[model samples]
Target chain A: MKKKDVLLKALKCAFPYTLPILAGFWFLGFAYGYLMNVSGFSFVYPLVMSICIFGGSLEFVAVSMLLSAFAPLQTVIMALMIQARHLFYGISMLDKYRGMGWKKFYLVYAMCDESFSINFTADIPQDVDRGWFYFFVSLLDQSYWVSGALLGALFGDLVHFNTKGLDFIMTAMFVTIFAEQWMKEKRHFSELAGFASGVIALVVFGPQRFMIPAMAGILALLYIFRRLVEKMWETGEDTE
Target chain B: MKMTLWQQAATIALCSLSTMATRFLPFIIFRDGERTPAFIRYLGRVLPGAVFALLIVYCLKDVSFFRYSYGLPEAAGIAATLILHKWKRQMLLSIAGGTAVYMILVQFVI
Candidate 1:
């Protein structure tokens, strides 16, 4: 197969994943835009932030931070903690993306919820171009985000429809993702691991400092019980 | 009481920059292959644990815990939801149920 054909085929394979991502961005971006506008910020500011920073939770937190002056360390810590999930997010994708060539960096960088979904679902066609598939997904995901932000910013300023429960969209999105993952293999052990580690951390560190430690404990358990863990899931059929 | 337009612009601009920079930073700094590098790999493995920590806790940040706390009602609702999630294995239903229960408590029962 010609290399060019491979790339085009890959692009076609990745087209469908863009829909959910676009939907998420539209809702999420709308919420963020409304928050910023209501908080006394302007449309252009959010428009730019959506384009550049693109971090949803952080931006939400940032509206308050901007109201007050925070030290650099405080700002950095807030951003890091909120995004701390990405660390584990990266780990799962390690082997799958090991050989992406020039696209490797962008692929890793762009691995937000949407990007991760399509990529995790990716099955590189032996004869088709996986590169184009990846590139298209990445491009489409970013476009959804940028477009959604701008749209929200434009509409949010003029229209103040009651957005009371809309803030829960991120929570809904995460829950949906976790449920989907759970369904794929019913990896009950990981769920148990998550629950156990959380309870332990909650007891030890209380609610405040539990995150970092709980994460450490869960990973440690996964390592020590790697064989047992594998056996637990080995019974379930592979999602593939 | 009134914030000027550029002030709004500045606020949003700063916010947008801060948020994007945080999400995008490590991606640009670290190579994808180096995801296996010690620090990055450690983070990757702990992803779920870390996120679970944030999710569970952050949900509690706004409301106070004691002395006629709204959080108490909300927490009760959330706890019930969590239990339902584990037993029934229903995501949408659990959340809707929990949120509805909390809303009822907040609205009437207190």
Candidate 2:
């Protein structure tokens, strides 16, 4: 139908998927903004950082980087290490993200964990425009984050509620997503590899330095088992 | 804030730039119109399941199983989420229920 109708329909379809993210990002982003505030930065810092960076973990880590003495090299290296996971996200989304025209740029830029999960997994209706669906998902998710940051930065100490364990929302979100993926796939090799490699890497490398190693392990395991994995897909085991 | 405003701006700019670099690199390397390698395409299909798993583990990596709370709170939260999800199959319900359970446990019980 009309171009306006296409975007509206996609926006309607996309909003529901972002509701969970609304909660998670608000909680997490509020905390990030609050931290930046108490750490002596202005509200502008969180607003800009949330809009520009958009990576939760890195944004949090950047607070400390900002606090410390200026080390440009260290800053670049840290950003790369914290964000290397996005490379995997990019690789996974390459095909699905094709032919989006200009939206492809913003899609790649806003490819955070939450946005990627929804865009990659959600079964958008055929009538809805896929590109617009993806765009609205990313846009809505980022808006939640930016607003939350602004809220916390502006009024962090004024309201005091027990949000001690609220961060668990993210872990819970990922677990549910993983479970959903598990139910969808016929074979568990990739999931098992991901889990085992992550745990082993964590145990071996420790929490502070395990991400890259965990990623490497996952890639290696997947590579080694490519024949079987491809055969499984070839046999029509993947539901997607 | 020991760094000057200019330095701070540069730092944030560098961070945003580098983060974008990682996010955009793969797509840049494997352009859209050109034929993507078979192996990369295969990865695009299978990586989601594994990446989600990795994300879960990454979120919980900081929990100290051997220390004070002993990760009971985290374990309980995850169990609640999985059970609630499997039972109802509603994303919001599972996430909120698990988060509520964890909040109560941490704020009061634990």
Could you tell me the lDDT of residue B35 within candidate 1? 38
lDDT of 2 by residue, B1-110 (tens): 69899889999999999999999999999998999998888888888888999999899889999998999999999999999999999988999999999999999998
TM-score of 1: 0.65
**Per-residue lDDT for A117-194 in model 2, tens only?**
999889899999999999999999999999999999999988787779888888888888888899888888899889
**Candidates' DockQ values?**
0.19, 0.85
For model 1, the stretches where C-alpha displacement exceeds 4 angstroms are A1-12, A122-128, A160-173, A198-210, A233-240, B1-110
> TM-score of chain B, per candidate?
0.82, 0.96
lDDT (Cα, 0-100) at A1 in candidate 1: 73
Error of 1 at A20 (Å): 2.6
What C-alpha lDDT do the candidate models reach, one value each?
A: 0.61, 0.91
